[model samples]
Target: MEEQLRELGLEFTKEVREDFVNFRADPLAVVYPRSEEDVIKLVNFAREKKIPIVPWGAGTSLTGAVACKGCILVDMRYMSSILEINEVDWYARVQPGVNLGKLNEELSKRGFFFPPDPASFFLCTVGGAVANSSGGMRGVRYGTFREWVLALRVVLSSGEVIRVGEPLRKNRAGYDLVHLFVGSEGTLGIITEVWLRIIPTPRQRLVALVGYVSSLDSVAGIIIDMRRSGILPEIAEYVDDEVIRALNEHLNAGLRKSGGGILLLRVDEPDSERMREILRRWGVEAEVLNDEEWERMYSLRSQSALALKASAESMYVEDIVVPVSRLVEAVRRLRDLERKYNVRMPVIAHIGDGNLHPNILLERSEDADKIFDEVARLAVELGGSVSGEHGIGIQKAKVMGEQITSHSGKRVLEIMNGIKRLIDPESIMNPGKYVELAYEINRSEERRSSS
Candidate 1:
């Protein structure tokens, strides 16, 4: 196998290892391919050898999608390039390896910007974001990478390269196959190039309203009131006093501790008076900040995950979504877990959209699963998904199995498994994770019941 791979003339490193969460990619050979043709060649080799192939980006995957024991890990770093940015067409076509922040910076220079800005934007790759279908602070107005991706050029499991969709805004030429690859998590195929939809920079001078609420209940109340009034924010985020304390201690971010919680908001349209009225009714202290203060607040919000991680070596980052109506209930459930477990679960949320990340700080690594399950179960019971942005790798596969089976039919999982079979017939494309793993869990349950 080494002899054959070495003969391909692509840059190869033996026994390359990459780690994240619980998944480790200790590949037999890590190959760096500089272009689509090179990726095709490697893919062909993997197929012929019946070896698994995992495409890697910046390795920012919170899930275990990138975990490979002996698969051929294809690192796309060498292929990073911004091929074109057409302002008129409103699309930026680039190689999958381009850093997301770099791509946005280039777009911004041309008076346009890509909307999906993940917290890992500084470190993550456009390809990784696309595969995860990642959402961010701007997600309330802009949505995730799934919505921004106009088209993709992918190398199929069979080593066949095909381009799906177009750079144009309106094209109904075929089935929506573009979306199928958006969040496939490198399972379907290796994404070679990406055509992302772009938008002109907003002309409006947006200001932020930082609400220091008396409690999380009040925070939830403000969000519900804002929604009820038909006011849409560019971003609506909430972080409890615990996360604020973490930021101050670890990041040296001098932020006021909102005794109950802090609600950070930005508006495309100015309506601070109305927002103040809502906050005033809840007896919350508020301030509409200048750009400098707002920028600091925004940066603090983005660094929240890192701040909380300083407490313990590890944490179970919960990415659960509840209905907007059930936001208060979700917050209350988190409070109950803290009291029940006698531990702090610092919450950081994209509150406008109901996606909450309640970091379960672990004293011991083994202790988080039980709490994790309860949180996921809470989302499911409340008619919400187990995950909103963070994709299911190995960590959430069991819950995904239960969620899908209970909400959608068991047949839905079968259809998903069927799609995986259809695309990567050999099951050698990032195998043993994501949807495949979820289905396997259900099948295992069935067998246990029958036995």
Candidate 2:
């Protein structure tokens, strides 16, 4: 493989790589492709050699999505470019390697901005966010990357280049294959270019509300009450006391810590009073902030994971989402797990959407895997997804299989596996993860049951 890659005259390097969550990969060679043509050539060579190919974005993935052994890592950094920002068309055409923050900054100058602001927006690539279908603080109102992506140019495992979906919003020409690859986590194809739907920045006067609650249950109650009262905040986020401590200790963020946690809520000016009334009902006083103060809090929320990382040796960030109705139960279950394991699991959540990120401070603990699986299973039991935004990488494959089998059916898992096989017959494109790994785990369980 090395000789063949050298013969092809590609810019390749041998190195050890690691994702944000410490998932490591030792690739045979990491190839930097400068253009779509370069990606096509590399794909062709990998296909011919039957070597597994993994797409490299900004290395911001929390799951072990990009971790592979002996695989060819297609680093897209060299191809980073903002090709076009069509304000009239309300879309942005960009290379996969473009930094999401940079793209948004450019769009902001034109009075338009992409909505999907993942927590890693400042550090992550647009390709990684699209591939993970990432969600963030704005997810409560704007949705995730899956909703914003309009079209994609992908290089298949057979080295065939194909464009899926159109830049237009109302294209029904075929089966939404654009979405299939959106959160596929580099398992299906290598995305070389992306077209994202852009919208004008909200001009409405917005208010940011900060409050500290008594418990996780109080936070869940507030969200449920807001839902029942028909009050939708622009963004609703929570970071527990432990998370606040981490932020203060690591980032020097002097935050008031309550036994419960801190809640950050943003809403339009018209509904600001209503949001405040709701918080008061919860026995919590909310502080309304100006734009400048809100931006500081927003940045702090985005850096919650990083702050936790600085405080811990190793951390397993579990992205489990339960229905809003069952959030209290989920919190109770989480507390039980913490007590059972005798560990402090700090939480950061997009509470409006029930996407709870329970940071299990691993610290090289052997029982971390068991605790992680238990958290994921709790989501499934409560009729929620194992993963809300972060796709199932190598880490959550087994729990994903269990979720599918329990919620949808065994047939659903089989169909997903079928689609993966149909697309990459040789399993060269980021093989042995996501749907492929989920299907394999399901099959293994079946075999055990039969035995």
Candidate 3:
């Protein structure tokens, strides 16, 4: 296989490595594709040999989506390029390997910016973000990569190139296939280029409000109240006391250890006062941050996961979301689960939108999988999703199967599986992950129950 790859004049590596989430990948070879032609060639070769192919973009995935054994890792690093930034069209088209932070910097020069600022935006790729439909702090206001992506140029499993969507706002197309591939996690195809919607920079300055709550109970109540008051913040993030401690110990964040937790809210200049009023009404000691202080605070929250990872031997970051109305009850149940499991599940949330990431600290990974499933199940039971932004890779596949069956019905899963088959009939593109894994688990359970 290495010789065959080299014959095609592609840069190839025989080594495999683990992703950020600690999932190991043992690829037959890692091939770097500098162009769409290279990707097509690699795909054709892999298809001919019946070899699995997984796309790699910065390896910032929290799930095991990129992990493959004896497969081909199509490293898109060399394809990094900002192809076009249409100022008039309000879109930026770029290669899969373009760094997200760099893209934002370019957009900023034009008085525009991409809104989906994932925590790893500085290090992750635009392609990776689009693939995972990853969300971040601004997600509370701007939504996820799923919403920002206007179109994508993807190479299917059969080595055929296709563009999913137009770069325009209003397009009554055949179907919303753009969304189907947005969060597909590379299971369906390889994203070669992306066209993401951009917006002119907001003229109104946003004010940051830090509310020190006494407990998760207080934080939950505040979120519920904020929604009731109709005070939508640009960014409503939460970092628990334990997470604060981790940040301070690891990154010297020096954040105050509040009794409840810290609610970092950023709203437009006009709504700042109302946000403060809501904080005080919820018994939270609120203080507005200066411009400089706000930047540091946002950076600290963004680094919370890294801090937690450093503090623990192993970490399973849980991404679950309940309805806004069920936020309080969800928090209470999460607290109960923490006590029941006897683990330090330090939470960080996009609270305004009900997305919670409780970093579960463990000495060993033996229990991580079990706990991951448990938390995901709780989200489903609470009338929420098992995954809000992070796609369901191997780690959360069984729970995803359960969620789909219980909520969207078994037929929905079948339909999703059918789409996967429709796109990648050979099943060589990131096989045994995402929807495919969940469907596999469901089918196995069906077989067992029928027996």
Each model's lDDT: 0.87, 0.92, 0.89
Residue runs of model 3 more than 4 Å from their true location after superposition: none
66-102, model 2: which lDDT tens digit per residue?
A: 9999899999998899999998889999999999999
Clashing pairs in 3: 214-259, 214-260, 215-260
lDDT of 1: 0.87
What's the TM-score of every candidate structure? 0.97, 0.98, 0.98
lDDT-sorted candidate list, best first? 2, 3, 1
Candidate 2: regions farther than 4 A off: none
Per-residue lDDT of 1-451 in model 3, one digit per residue for the tens? 7778889999988887888878888988989999999999999999999999999999888888898898999889999999999999999999999999999999999999899989988889988888999999998889999888888899999999999899999898799989988999999899999999999999988888888888887788888888887878899999889998899999998888877679999888888787788777877758879989998998888888898898888888889988988888888888888888888888999988999998888987777777888888889999999999877888888998899999989999999999999989999999998889999999999999999
User: What's the C-alpha lDDT at position 68 in model 1?
Assistant: 80
Which of the predicted structures, 1 or 2, would earn the higher lDDT when compared with the native? 2
Residue-by-residue lDDT tens digits, candidate 1, 1-451: 7788778878888865654454678888899999888998899999888899998888877767788888899989988999999989999999989999899889889999898888888888888889889999999888889899999999998989999999989989988999999999999999999999999998887768888877888888888998898878889999999888989999998878768878999875467667777778899767888999988888888888878877666777889999999999988988898888876688899999989998888777666888888899999989999888888877788998889989998999999999999999999899988899999989998999999
For model 3, the run of ten residues with the poorest summed lDDT: 277-286
User: What value does the lDDT take at residue 13 in candidate 2?
Assistant: 91
Kindly give the stretch of ten consecutive residues in candidate 1 with the minimal lDDT sum. Answer: 15-24
TM-score of 2: 0.98
